[model samples]
Target: MTTDGFTTCLWFDGQAEEAAHYYVSVFKNSSVGRVSHYTEGAMQPAGTVLTVEFTANGHKFVALNGGPQFKFTEAISFQVFCDNQEEIDYYWTKLTEGGGEPGPCGWLKDRFGVSWQIIPERLDEMISDPDTAKSSRAMQAMLKMHKLDIAALEKAYAGE
Candidate 1:
C-alpha cells in the first residue's frame, strides 16, 4: 500500500461519538480508534470529543463535534465494490435501516445522510464491454435501478 491513506472528517453537531460508534458497527474490518477530548476550557462546551477516529471497512474516518456549520451532500459518495449480489443486498439493506434513501444506479444515503454506492463488480465490466450495444444496454439497465440488480444487468447485456 504505497499510496498514503487519508481519513474523511465528519463534522457532527453533537453526535460525533454516536456516529463513530454507529459506523464502526456497520462495516467489516472496522474499529474505533483514538478518541481525543477537549481539555477544560479548550472548547465552548469543555469535555467534548474533539476528535474520534474510526475505521470502517478498512477506510478511516474522523468525526468531530464541530458545530452545524457544514453538512454532507450527495456530491461526494463512498463506493462499495461488491463482488456478488449477496454483498450488495446486505449493505443496501443494512445502510437503509433508518432514514437512508435508495436511489438509482446502486446509490443510497445512510441514516446519517452520507451517500454510498453499492456497486456490483461485474457491472463495471459490462459497461466496458467491447460491444457498444451490450455496454449501452447495461448502462441503461443500471440507470433505472435503486439497489442495482446484477442479474438484470446481465440479462440486458445478453439482449434478454
Candidate 2:
C-alpha cells in the first residue's frame, strides 16, 4: 500500500548500537542514523539503546536490542552479488573475520551470527544454464568451495 520500501530489522542482545556502527564501517555509502533509547519502566534500563537506525549500502535497517531470546540462523541470509573475484574476496574476508564461520557454497555466519552469501553476480546464470552438463559442473564446483571462486566456476561451466 505504502510506497516506502521495507526496512530490515535485526535483533540483538544489547548490541544494536555496536552492530549498527560495525555494519556502517563495513559497507560503502553507509551511515548511522537515529538511535532510540529505552525509557522508564521499559524492559531494558533507562537510557539504554532500544533501536538503532542505519543505512548500509543504501538499504535501510533497524537494529533492535530485543534481548537474547532470538538468534540469527542460516534459514535467513543476506546475499552480496559480486562482480568479480576481488569483490567476492573482499566481502568474504570482511564478513568472515572476527570469529565469522565459513559455510559451504559461499555461505558464512559473521561474528554477530548474521548469515551472508558472498556470490559472484554471474553465478546464478551459470548455475541455471539450460545445458544440464554445464550447470551441473558449475553447481558441483560451487558445492566444494567455502568462498566462491569465479574463475573456477567459470572453468567448470565451460567443462575445462
Candidate 3:
C-alpha cells in the first residue's frame, strides 16, 4: 500500500475489459486508464486480456482476468455516497441493470456479480442523530428500504 494511491483489484473470469467498460459507462467521473494483454509465458492464453485499470466515480480499480476460480461476494462492496434521492436513483438503476439483483438497505449486485451500496450521504448523520429517538426512527426507515429515500428518512427522523 503506497501513499501515492490505492486500487481495489477485481477478479473476473476473462471479462476484465468488458467490466472496465461497463463500470466506466456507469460512473459519473470514471474512465478506463489502461488495458494490458497477456503474452507468451503468462498463465492465461497468449494475447488474452491480462489486466485493466479503470476509475469508477474517481475510485481507482484494477480488473484482473483471474479465471472463474474465485467470485465476488457480499462480504465486500463499493459504497457510493450520494447527496440526494436523484443521485441514489441514478446509481441504483444503472447498477442494477442487466442481471443485477437488488438487496435490502440500498445494496445491489451488478450483472458482473459485484455488490454495490448506493447510500445517501445524509443517512449516516440521521442514523447517528444526537436524539436517540430520531436516530432509531432513521434506522427503522433505512432497514425497510431497498433504494434509500432521503425524504422518508428525514421524515422518520423528525418523528413524522
Looking at model 2, which ten-residue stretch has the lowest summed lDDT?
A: 1-10
Candidate 2 global Cα RMSD: 1.8
Query: For every model shown, what is its TM-score relative to the native structure?
Result: 0.92, 0.97, 0.94
The TM-score leader among the candidates is 2
lDDT of 3 by residue, 1-160 (tens): 1335788999999889999999999987898887888999888989899999898888888999999899999999989999888999999999999989999999999999999999999888888879999999999999999988999899999999
Candidate 1 local Cα displacement, residue 43, angstroms: 4.4
**Taking the tens digit of each residue's C-alpha lDDT, what string does model 2 give over 1-100?**
1227999999999999999998898889899989999999999999999999998998889999999999999999999999989889989998888999
lDDT of candidate 3 vs native? Answer: 0.91
Each model's lDDT: 0.87, 0.94, 0.91
Candidate 1 C-alpha lDDT tens digits along 1-160: 1225787888887888888898888889999988888888775467778889888899888899888888889999999999999999999998998778998789999887889999998888899999999999999999988899889999999999
Clashes of 3: 0
Best lDDT goes to which candidate?
A: 2
Error of 2 at 22 (Å): 0.8
